[model samples]
Target: MNTPRLAHRPVPPHRPYRSKEFPVPDTQTQPLDPVALHRDSVVFNALDCTPLAWADETYLGKLAASGVTAINHAVSVSQGYDAAAAALVGWQHRLAETDGRVFQAYGLDDVTRAKETGTVAWFAGFEDSKPVGEDLWRLAALHQLGLRFMGLTYQNRNYAADGSGESANGGLSRFGRSLVAECNRLGIALDLSHTGERSTLETIETSTKPVLVTHAGLTHFVDSPRNKSDLVVRELAARGGVFGLAAKSGFLTPDGLTRRPGAEVFADNIDYLVELAGIDHVIVGTDVGDERKYSREGMARVRRLYPEIPIVGADLDLERIHPEGLGTPADLPLITELLAGRGYSGEDIGKVLGGNLQRVLAEIWDSASGE
Candidate 1:
């Protein structure tokens, strides 16, 4: 046999396949005890599904096991004020039924207690301020319901402002400015994750208190409208604001259109921000949505499209792929391990993990107290 013609010979003009490449840390060794490293660490997940979104007791247990100390419970993404208010009441009732497995954090005391008891503190937030309604008084009502943070808009335009993805991203409208002022007065944390450029800039300038872009990527990294620019990042940090890096694959990588990279890519994005803004301004906000809803079919399609990319499975295991070594909330120790490998001191890693968010929360709560 003529060497069997090396079955499936390539045709003319065929090029050799090149293996995908990712940066590897120079240090070869990992920490001896990742669990001990994460023992005192806390995860501040800025946005996640609540009961309204189908997150149940099992889910909450998973979250607790994952090491999530607090989550900014998204109460209203598009609900009107009446509906949002009702939903808040419902959540409170559910918490009562769960025997305070989840506590709503309205002030520093609540957060401290949650930390002490190892309970998941629910920091109320509206994904879209649409519920604040045309009337600004509705904001006061929502604030009363312990809605501590407010995202000015979702993925579409609303009365307060244009969303980042809007076709015409004119900054905050007149009403939006008014709403920001009210949010400032009421002691609510302003979030600009999906706000348009103009709106984000205007809100940053208008708010007397430091605002939060709870979860987002850098514009330079992925160039998505949803990603914040370097200028915005610098300004936010200058005002003592915190930028929580998101886990959404689309905004985190250059090839978001294909495969979502793991924590390594996420860490690269974090590295960029830390390099630009320093560790004090960087924090984790996976923006990891309802884990129960992620389907195998969807992941399979993603895998096929970006064969070189690694997709975080529905189980939320970050250690398998993320360079940061963050798999689940429980796997937070991996971050310490990776940071150690990168030569980051314990202090620096602590700040990035939770200290920064704690500072921001304290500032906002203090401002509210004064008012």
Candidate 2:
């Protein structure tokens, strides 16, 4: 069960922050034009666990207010098939009850409407494809339920493939190959975020349609087991696939330990990917979860363990939090502005925001329908 070790890249010299003491600016010196900033820029959220994170309707409303074009709702991961199916059913019920407020995207029209109205279009995606069971027919059933995208596995070995963090690091299983073909037939886009290296490469070679690594980072930047190699990034891009940059703090830094400065670090990752793979293949896929409930509980637990420094609620600043700016979904405009400041053109920004993902989705959906 020996996993292949990732080849290391020389760590870039850490850039000195403008102000290390204060990560976030207190006030905006120049106001960003919201309308102008949002123009041609479509935010494609690769992962959002808000539904599972918040009980308050206000939080959901906050997300809707964010002007996000689309979100890939993770329905299954680290859960059994039955549980995964149940989660999908529950999400569908929520969407129906919400009455298109959080509508499910089954085709291009759904995405079009999301752009026009500014409502969040939810695409059912399984964080792990373990729920497909041993039978390939289950893929069709899941697709009928609006499961458009699926990862082969989560952070462990499954029937289909081995995860990136798994010790075995096996390639796609026989059942995994069948599942990939079925996904091709059904028009589902295979995601290889948490999948092992061998499995990911094998999947890229096998799938008829383009694939997506919905949320991940470069192992060269951060030595985390979850991040992919630069070689894999190049291979995926060459195959017409999209590599969605994840927002997870650990995955983006070199040490995979300390939290790097928010927007700056995010920009660095973007620049790195653009250097390796063209700008057209890079997209933002923030795997941010709702921290409203968990933060307090986690803080309380931490206080019990280490009561030396009293960490109060005031110390929690969502604005400067994470290496990828945090302030619910509403803060996406800031990212666009940051990208622009980094000298990226409007077209490049658009591709990073949503165009890249749209291309892959359209390709996969068309292939599925043709079958």
Candidate 3:
């Protein structure tokens, strides 16, 4: 019988599936006593989530155990207004279902609240702006529904701008620029994570408030269409924005080594970003999670979007998405543990973990909270 095919088919270019891969440092299972530092520190994730099924109590338990203060949860995707509204409301209901363990975060204070109360703060974001459709007025209502940010594109062309893969790299459309102003006015942060480099830089130049590339890597490391260039990153820094270092191995390394990249590799990426962008501008935004089943389903869903190619990610099993050792929210302590071992000062480590995001959020959100 033909062997069952792997759910994630490998694509050309980075054949990471080849048995002989780059030699990674040994420490696949190295155990470390959990660091107590994160407990007191506000451990906010700029972008990432693999929240458990709402019905599962383990979801709430795992979050507390992981010490996650907040995350930019992707509650809606390329959806219509009604569907997106349902998602936004559903998330609020999820938090209520948790009986106050997780709270809806609208401002920097909400994050502080979560940190102090030992709960996870959920800041809702959209992976794309399609949910708003042609009507600019919809964004106002959506913002009221607790939608905090929206990516102009999902690495593909949209009404706002060209995604990473689009040949139309002409930057933001006229309507796109209009929406940017409205978002600035309405306190909805603009996330450039999945947008084209040209569009991203253009958005930065256009925005009055700081824009975020929530879960991205520098092209200086792994040069991919999805990664940002030095020019773009420098611009983002000069504008007082933050580049959230991602944990996905593909973004971390060009070889597509997400299968077994240890937490040390993630720490090294942090070090590089800090060197390039300085500590205050660098932060963690791991697009990872612990739940394998949900993650696999998430991948399949994304793949359907690009039926012609669906080449968003390297071909690897669902397990590679989170990487080994650094797989779940609970494993987050490992990064802090490694950072401490690397001689990072508590203040610096604290900034890398969440303090940086706190600062940016305050300026961007609070300054624009007028709307």
Candidate 4:
């Protein structure tokens, strides 16, 4: 299989973490105050953050400010074997830098503790499982090192399977099948967010343990390659898997240029998935990291360099400053308010926030406890 040349948006260079911290852009949008409710709920922003390259007290403050109880932070992606290995090393160093201010969630107990203590419970995840390479044996070692969620592919084909960019839609490679079994045995949840349609559906059938498409749009809404088909979503829900909704402009809209549809569109997605796949299977995964605005020149440069993937974000216009609500971590509470307005009860809201993913985690992790 030919691995397509992927021109990806380069991660921006490190800068000083800004403060004065995002004042809610839409005060008149909702009457319900979700601060206390968000604090109480077990919020998990699946695959939201890119692991930091540098560490400091500012990083600590930004991490805490998300108000998210837990994050399946993608520490590794778009790297070869050596760089991927080093990514894990970097994550370990950052985790150590927290000095217990952050907690690692290996199981439910750790997650509960993080919720109770008001600390960020970060469970390590990778956007692609290519890091393990052909050494399926290494999965256990990485799991021991705190890797809990792993995607089979990211944007393009790997040794495991084809990603969305591949039109062939190949299922698991021989090694990919072995990988699925290893992940099931090791308690690493198989994340199929960027995986191709065939590979994702096949994995759903192959894995004994329930899987999760932790971050992607719904084809039922936008009919994009980056989103899942309705049939796939239904089958996943039937087999006890969870589907997490992502917060990306292109996947969410036609032109992929605005964030205004966030509240209504995201709420409608949750409701649609709930009706089709059931509420138990729907969850949250803002595929974006932090909300850092890019300059027009920066956006233009990205468009010029990576023509395949354009400025599918709010920063399409350099001078235009639109209200980016759910575009970042801070605007997450708006989800709660929107869901409430949609007539979701507290119990249902809890499940959508993190309870669904929480259940999937226990099922996978607890079963592999003896490992």
Candidate 5:
């Protein structure tokens, strides 16, 4: 399938950075206050893989403290239909138990309402499409239950498509094409972050609406196969899709495990993505997990689940997966500061912060209505 190459706005030139270091823009002028800007802006994290007890006061408190207004929370991570459905229902109940403190968002209006109410909005997302199984109706059922976005695969292949971790890039299965059509018809945005190369490209061409790479690193900076190549990234942006530059340290730096790169590296990653995908196509997607996720028990659980995936190997420190100063949602204001320090205009900074994802999501969500 031939996809028309959509033109992108001229990219801003980025200065070369020494490994693990980002140079501050040369200027004597006072830098913009990112704290204030973050507070007022409609900050959206396209994806955050942190598993949390939805009604937990501590978790809710952390979100309340963060500059983020909305988050695409991963509800299904490599789970099959039954498990995924149960998880979705559990989150729904939790949101109901939150006593209006946290709202489960279904569309752009919910985001606006969340901003106006000064509360956090959670968009239910799936990190894998295993839950769909071989049935499109199951997908529609999940969507009606608030499953807004879904990935074609996790780090491994399922019935629909191959994941990035697969040795064989078989692309999307026949079932996958049907899944894409179902997602388009149901107004559910598709995600290709952990999908295999061929599968990712195929899905982009197949989908009627813009897709999302919600959380992943760029292979240009870190030569990890888990990251997306420039070819895939550019194609995604050219088709009006959004690329979420992640905060994973291991994927962000050369010796990320011991080096423990700070927010500077993350800022640089954002800059690299903006240069490649254009500022309008980039957004923040942090994979920073919570305390339980980094616990030794958590590592054991992950290893048991996917022993072959190198990301869960014993050598990696789950706590250091994300760069310093960006380990939690509360620290997101630092991103705005770094972008401003790098000479990004307030308009562009807002776009990167959340505006870009918002625009594409609205485009995808509203596509069904237009049809």
Candidate 6:
């Protein structure tokens, strides 16, 4: 019998899945310990595009407090090759500056080593193919510099494909097919978070490796174009891919701009994804970033950049962008707490937290170079 490419890998009994060690009161009046559960699990954040310059001592301290094993850091997006290369080099220097607090991760072994050493492993990713710019050699070079996952487009059209904001819903271009094939050859996973719906489905069908929607929600909850349809979600799971439930309130509910969404909002989305795609294909990708983005100035700047969503209206409160109790990576354990309270088994929670994403990466990142 052929095993599913991204089948669930259960945690060993010897390993800590969850226990009653750290007692916390639950709605069911049972003992549930989310702290210990999160501490013991290999939590991986599939998408984090926070600027590298923000990784100062306090920021790094917050990351250490988050208990995350690894993160797919966006090195560049919506930019050309030169700018993207500079951004990548800048991240390398920032990682070096961490002084052993952070480790550059290229594979599962590196993730294991980071978790063992109590340091965060960071792998580089690109949110668009504009950086490669008609040169497959440039793509290989970026891969050499540690680009593990890449999207075909951001929220706009590029040389490869139309983005989610495009009206035409055009499929992948000839160059886009080449991009998908090159990503497969170079051990890089494809991401479809911001690609057009048609382009996303086509890329999944075109690639030999499993694709990832690194940070997105479901249209079943929020009717925004940024959210995936149930059809896309089902197809993604059928192809052995994983879906990351984003924590952005704008994509969680229709009234998100009017009020503060609590962690329950995220829990509900997680529940929906699990029910629709099964436990083994669901994971978390809280898209929280530097606190400055919540400020009026930052919000205005963002509005100017991507006007398609028009999320930041004058009347909308910036504080409502991220769900309460999950405003940053430091609060990620709350997902574990919420899931546990919802009666999810410890092993299943482990898969949702990071194991599923870990398995998908292992399958997609497989190549001869083994880099």
Candidate 1 is scored at a TM of 0.80
Q: TM-score for all predictions?
A: 0.80, 0.82, 0.84, 0.83, 0.88, 0.89
State each model's C-alpha RMSD to the native: 14.5, 9.1, 11.5, 9.5, 6.4, 5.9
Q: Write the per-residue lDDT of candidate 1 for residues 65-91, one digit (tens) a residue.
A: 766667787777778888888988888
* Candidate 6 C-alpha lDDT tens digits along 81-195: 9999999888888889888788788888887778788999998889899898888889989899888988888989898888988878888899999988888888898899988
Report the Cα lDDT for candidate 6: 0.79
Instruction: State the lDDT of candidate 5 residue by residue for 1-371, as single tens digits.
Output: 23234334443332211111212222346555667667767888888666656347777777787767889998889898998989888888888888888878998778878887888889999999999889888988898888998988998989998888777877789999999988888888899988988889888888878899988888877777678889999888877888887777767777775667778998888888888888888887886545445666766776676553334436656656667788775667778889888888766777777778877887788767522
Q: How accurate is candidate 5 locally (lDDT)?
A: 0.78
Task: Pick the TM-score winner.
Answer: 6
Query: lDDT score of model 4?
Result: 0.72
Off by over 4 Å in 6: 1-31, 368-371
Q: Least accurate stretch of 10 residues (summed lDDT) in model 2?
A: 14-23
Which pairs clash (backbone N, Cα, C closer than 3 Å) in model 6?
none
lDDT, candidate 3, at 195:
85
lDDT of 3 at 196: 84
Weakest 10 consecutive residues, lDDT, candidate 6? 10-19
lDDT against the true structure, per candidate, is: 0.69, 0.71, 0.71, 0.72, 0.78, 0.79
* TM-score pick, better of 1 and 4: 4
lDDT of candidate model 3 versus the reference? 0.71
The residue-by-residue lDDT of candidate 2 on 60-157, one tens digit each, is: 67666566778887777667778888988887777776656778888666877777776778888888887877877777888888888898887778
- Clashing pairs for predicted structure model 2, backbone only: none
Write the residue-wise lDDT of candidate 3 on 1-371 in tens digits. 11112122222221111101212112335433336566656788877655435425665566677788888887775778798888888878877877788878888778767766777888888888988787888998888888886777787787888887665565889999998999888888788878887788888888877788888777877777777887777677767778886777667765554345556767777778777777777777876655643545566666676532222354535555544666666666777888878877766667767777777777667777544
The per-residue C-alpha lDDT of model 5 at residue 222 equals 77
Pitting candidate 5 against candidate 6, the one with the higher lDDT is 6
| Candidate 3 Cα deviation (angstroms), residue 109 | 1.7
Q: What value does the lDDT take at residue 317 in candidate 1?
A: 43
